[model samples]
Target: MNRIPYANAVGAIMYTMTCTRPDVAYALGVTSRYQADPGEEHWKVVKTILKYLRRTKDQFLIYGDSDLKIEGYTDASFASDKDDSKSISGYVFTLNGGAVSSKSSKQATVADSVTEAEYIAASEAAKEAVWMKKFISELSVVPSIEESVPLLCDNTGAIAQAKEARSHQKSKHGLRRYHLIRALLNVETSEFKRLMERKMQQIHSLKHLVSKSLHETLDLGNINSIPNTDDYLWTHGAISDETLSLERTVCNDSTYMRLTVRGRRSQGCDYVFSRVSDEIGADVEHDDLLLPKCLSSSSAQFRPLGLHGKIHAAIARRANIGDPCLPERIFTYLNRPDVQKALHANTTHLPYLWHSCSGPLQYQQDNLDLNIIPLVLDILKEGIPILLFSGDQDSLIPLTQTRTIANILAKDAKLLTMDKYGPWYDGKQVGGWSQSFGEERDGKNVTSLTYATVRGAAHEVPFSSPSQALTLFLSFLKGSALPRPHA
Candidate 1:
């Protein structure tokens, strides 16, 4: 065994185990048993496993924040070993939205029947599940685990054996002293259900459905694609010669008062205009001169008229002698109350509140964009629909652990019973259950929780089963009824 480069082989397998090979846990465990022995066949098997890993290298796991729901799978292979005849057991846990922990190992003792072996395996899986439930409660992340967390087992016989104490007499191997699953169940530690293998197929279908839905809902396929610029013409079209000219004029004015009609519109181009109207009123020939004397003596009282008197004098001095082009409407419009009000409103000093909270605004603008995690958590607490998914075939983190962690976090989560939609291959019906929280409580937000397994898929659900997975995911996200499988 040492001559076969066992360390290197084990390291490669370990890497896969940690990354994407939850399905290989049992295989890896069995292979490790032969690590101490010298055998060419072991090397061949290990090499084959290595080739499998190389083929699936791109299978990474993705964990996201989603609706808090707890569900998982527990599986074991009985009497698989030729040398020791020991069974291999595996379990996975998920939470908040990803796999957290999982294990695959050989059973400690030999068993007589497949059911007995599976019972032992489920017991071990249950212990881990209980520990995870307790751990999540301590973190204050999951609500509570007082209620049962559904653990799905494919072996109906094993499930029955585990649930009933009377069936143990049929076993040759005495039950392990630590087989406390029944006691735990009596006290409501966790719950176990016998799931048909066909249900796993449904879960697998649902997984694909959800993954497709996520892709469609989030449009992840095109997220990194180059954006089309064809429709951006309007945005670019805003830059025009007229706009440029106006911007230049505004920029050049110091006080901006030079833009007024009374000021010189252009340098050295004396196209000056003024209005002179002879109004019938009580007046003498020296009225203009006496007006200034009266205005000066009573400047405070006649301030409003004083400015008008000076304007009238300036107009009398500058009026073009015979320019018929000068329009009287210009002066009349300039003096209109609406025009004055418009100018006052356009002045920059008006209430404009954007500047008032500039400091806090900048701080939030820069930091708030990256801080959506807390917001997501807040929304989850409010009971909004959130779904986190992981492929069991995923390498980054095992979906087994993700399921375990989810159960721990959402221990009190209500369970939706599995219902048969229709039959798949061999007349086996396909269906699964979902649960929700915060939907009915007063002032609580609504969140629907679901977990679906993908059959024979490594990590990518949609890639494995596009049509079924897409349909399920769309229905879940849209809050529409999940499509029934064809009978």
Candidate 2:
């Protein structure tokens, strides 16, 4: 693979980018990643860049068309690379409508969100701004170079982060993403450093939450096939006049992996307050999870353990049932004084310190006759992205069932297959098998729906295989196509 003169061609391209052609910086940066172990695929990229250069050879950089003011533009493609989840940060400083300095490179650290990615990119650009400001001011070639440079950033969240202290205070998880004191705290600084931490940090689940309380509940609307929702059901027609309001828990903190969602029917805007453990669906149910057929056969054995106890016993064990030590660990954690203070076998209250709550011994389960594929299609039709993931090891919401649902949704949506089923990666190891489906928009295949399976993960993928889960999550958020196995 390394036999070709891949490095030489890359060097020439780099020279061309540095000398005059700033537009090629991004492509050059991506192609440079495979220089050490170049393959036929990577070699093709180099050739393509060469062809581009040949076609545009006549064009040259022209300056002095605009004012002497320097305009700095910074942008970032958040988690654009599939392999490492690193963002691509590019910045160009233009003087008199011609680029004087430009850089396209991978961020050293993984940004937690798009706003953070932009802030980090802006952070890097500030350094270049400072350097250019000084150089041009000393050269005295352009007026107002010593004044504050007109740095443009498209993301308002980043601007707020700089101006508002509360936003900066709330975002304390990924501080290394940018030097907050120097850049986000607002200023350009010394020479830029490329070593922004690129590795995906382990998700810190139990952070000191700033939401003031552990749990909050709101009144939500009807479920599918309910009295008011029947009008939108499959038999009625495929079209929905109203858009259902589905609100996912905000990723304000590190607890984004803990999915606590609230969905409402647009007809009545009614919802139920119930913290479902695992998935309440019958697909994940096992013999252990199911209650005894009658109280007579199980009454004596279950008389002491009330309904809530039995419910917790069955559901909690599913987390790590394979381990013999898990039961004792769960017992210890559950019996903690602090844990008991918050959870007292009855949930119908607020001001609690516990994370979430669940239903009583008996509850109203969803109707078996309802088919949610139509509802899913409605959401997809609204252009909202949907990601369906399953753990191969999960019994409850089995992988096969989720995969079938994903197929059904795709067929119903009439989406084209963007990438056929293939293995995606977390670092160098195989993380999972995934496939994407989407409709083309503006000459580009925009993946609106994805189905993936995390290898060796259980019902809760993140709990069992965090790294792979993180990989899947970042890909979905970035809207980047999953990397094929061979690549």
Candidate 3:
């Protein structure tokens, strides 16, 4: 038995059991118990199960003809386990006349009677029913889902005892607190209507002024220039334009850096500089776009460039550069000499970078020390849903910084924790980790505030992790908390 690779064989069976064959669930559950130390008898049983799966490999679940009504059935076998006399609880939920969800597992406690065992199974189904009800509501296709979903069971006494909530000597089970974490939603573009809101909406952003006082301290403890090493450029694919601006603005460009990337679609290299470009390989033509009204004066009138990650207080976190040439190509494409001359043809300045002519925007040194925590608290008082998501590898604002800020905001707002820290999903794979804080009333979790960390994403989350970003945004827009992994 030790030589037969018992655990590996059982683990292989689990994938088939979870995805396609609920029929194998009970048998797999039974065999899985002996995976730790399977005897020769258990190895034979595992082989039999694998053989059975091989025979039924061609069988598939059929759907599409039946109505969309969700029907649930639950059953239990009392004292099914001979080792400990524990009851086995099982439930299956059907939609479109096919099994959409199913579970077969041992009960936490042993039930004394058949009715008690059946009731325990019903409770598990009840939780799933609530979850399905909410999920269907999110779909918005079914008009009659507001009504309570009906659960089918064979035992009549268990149903009556379930309606009577008071605990009795024979029935000794308690309800668990918290929302059901399992919600299966398709995040694909084809099923857009099934998961997301179709209505168009307008958003208004409140702009706050930055004070001239700079109080945000720069943490230059571990930051240093990689003069002749692979620590910076190689470890993290390459430095991004956003991080370049972040280095220049926050760290004052002490870590001198330059990146040269060639676009796959282009024949030439795309140039990027961490500081002001000195006009190197890029082709340039003389233009009069920057000639000031007072030509004798040297007071600069042109702004450098726009970078969203140049915020004063955000932390410097490291991440791999995923589309190295995209930003540089975009900048090059927008700042062509002919394009610049066509844009502003009359005046010019000593601007010899990609912009051969000076732009209308100039640099600003005003920094703010205002407390925006109170502003966030006021917004929370209005009870609008707020989702704050950060990339785990964001160089501008890291997940740790964002999480700490979120924790402080939740504490100040006097919100209760609705969803504890856990992994949320993009399809079956873990997309990221999330936690929600909200105001609860009437025994319902109304999640008005949530914070999520997108795994392996850069500062520009959508640009780096599009799939996970889409999932996070859709869940937030649907007023649903990030979907958690099934327990």
| Top candidate by lDDT | 2
lDDT of 2 by residue, 4-71 (tens): 88999999988987877666666677688888788898888778778766644433443442347787
Give every collision pair in model 3. Answer: 288-347, 288-348, 289-347, 289-348, 290-347, 290-348, 290-349, 291-347, 291-348, 303-361
The CA-based lDDT of model 3 is what? 0.55
Best-to-worst order by TM-score is: 1, 2, 3
Better of 1 and 2 by lDDT: 2
- In model 2, what is the error at residue 209, expressed in angstroms? 46
CA shift at 262, candidate 3, in angstroms? 39
Better of 1 and 3 by lDDT: 3
**Shift of residue 483 alpha carbon in model 2, Å:** 63
lDDT of 1 by residue, 1-487 (tens): 5556975787778786777565455456556777667488777767767765553333323333244546557777778778999987767666533456677667888877777777777788788878878877787756645456777788787777667676566344545543477787777777887675434411112223212322232211121111111111112232244433332322222112122323323321111111001111222111122222222333243232322332232122111222211122234455455775787632444443222124344323222113233344455566665554443333223344344333433443443323322322212434232233334447634345444443322234454334445655776679644444465
- Residue 196, candidate 1: Cα error in Å is 4.8
Cα-based lDDT for every prediction: 0.46, 0.57, 0.55
Clash totals for all candidate models: 32, 11, 10
Give lDDT for model 2.
0.57
Model 3 residue runs over 4 Å out of place are: 1-323, 338-367
